[model samples]
Target: MIYDVYTALPTTSVKEVLGTFEKNKIGGVPVVDGKGILVGMVTDGDIVRFLSLQEKVYFTFSMAYVGETEPIEKVLKQRMNTPISEIMVKKNLKTLSTDDTMESALSLLSKHHFKKLPVVNGVGRVVGIISRGDVINRLAKMTSDSLTIS
Candidate 1:
């Protein structure tokens, strides 16, 4: 678990960030500053929300019709290509310690429905990432042990 974490620096761009995430097939990334202190988190939802107003794809629902069709240039003008530091969620970072139990980690995951949780050391530097997939995979492994028992 300690070795399973993925991290991204705040300097990472939206495109590069998404690329790294796609390469790793992860849903989210922790946005850390230069010193590796946890600053904020970025998820796929945030990106979708950011770009949602620009392009009008095929409408899947009635709500899509309600969305304003702003010009791409106008939208871009209003858009703040701010760094992760400016946009990432500052509060409610569900973090875990390196030595914390998996049960505790699972509890945090289930409660917040977070895709990734930062694993930090005593100084609060991120050392790992515990994702929901990681939890599910671990649960599957534990279940396998019980499957053989009874």
Candidate 2:
């Protein structure tokens, strides 16, 4: 479990979040209230989407894919004072419990291609976070243990 979780509040500004990301080198954070209950999730992607107002898309031979977005720095500075609640992912968040299996967490992460999953307690407060990096490290360790030459 990654206990070094960073957090933000709904009232946190877009610039503040971006600065937090820069300082902490994290792509996202959990948005909590005064009590630290998980109210929503915020990511650099989310902020980018909000700043861009819409995403560009293109069609391929068989399918369509979203195109790249504009640089976020200018917009971040322009809308620096905007509250995070304006763009946070607040509805039907996919979360994990402390007792959840690593397999479950990995499956969800793989399916959604999420960078991190918030681990919550029974009362719905975030306790820790599990990231794809954590899963890969653990898998590497397990494989190494099984392949040890004795």
Candidate 3:
């Protein structure tokens, strides 16, 4: 579990979220409220899905033209100011508690194919983050220690 977790606020702008992703070299972050309670999650996939260009088709006399409603640059600039809350996954989010064991975290990550899970306290405030990599590393260390000759 990573105690030093990167997080975003509900009102954080899409541009800011992207900056955080780039700066920290991370793929996703848990969105927290002002009180530090987990509200949602924002991921690179979510932003890409939200920013996908919409196809526009125009039909003329015996002709058709297919194009995007707006230019990609225009869409990007416009969406940069949008709040993360608009695109964050707010419903049916999976999370972990501090009391959860490594087996539980690994089970959740592998079963659901999640890269990371937010660890929260009794009040739902984010305390840390556990990723698949973290679990795998710990397991490897334990195995190596067990195999080591005295």
Candidate 4:
């Protein structure tokens, strides 16, 4: 329903968005305007791809992970302080209205293979997000109940 969204602003930083995504275990988040309209989306994959293409150094470490970062001050000087607008996907956004049927939502998800779709109003403001996981969870609960009843 309309209660499913975790909203964020477009002005947020790539680093900030990454933290939010990691903490929430979400693939991406909708970037909204003042009126709540969908402006763009930022995904974890986008950040990974952007970083992978950049020059990086590797060092052997006993830990399961290696630290990779450009110094914050140096990064700020290089404008790695750049905002989310630079990296977010701004075109060909797929969205649905609150009035749209569950079948329509499912179809959009199936066709686009999107983990989440922004739910918008007539004026294009984002009201919520419908995710594949949400749909699957709903269906799973329904199936479980039906089995128990039968």
Tens digits of per-residue lDDT, candidate 4, 16-88, equal: 7777877877788888877777889887787766555333455566535445666555654554445788888
In order of TM-score, best first, we have 3, 2, 1, 4
For each candidate, what is the lDDT?
0.75, 0.89, 0.93, 0.77
TM-score of 2: 0.82
Could you say which candidate leads in lDDT?
3
Q: Write the per-residue lDDT of candidate 2 for residues 1-150, one digit (tens) a residue.
A: 789789999999988999999999999999999988999999999977777744579998999999876467766667779999998999989889999998999899999989998999999888999999999998998899889586
List, residue by residue over 15-106, the lDDT tens digit for candidate 1: 66667678988767888878888888888787667756654555665644445588766665565454555556778788999899999999
Q: Which regions of candidate 2 deviate over 4 angstroms? A: 53-74
Clash number for candidate 2? 0
Model 3 TM-score is 0.89
lDDT of 2 at 142: 85
Candidate 3 ranges with C-alpha deviation above 4 Å = 57-66, 148-150
* Reference-based TM-score, model 4: 0.73
* Best candidate according to TM-score: 3
C-alpha displacement of 13 in model 4, angstroms?
1.4
Candidate 1: where are CA atoms >4 Å away?
2-6, 54-67, 72-80
Can you give the lDDT of residue 117 in candidate 2?
Answer: 88
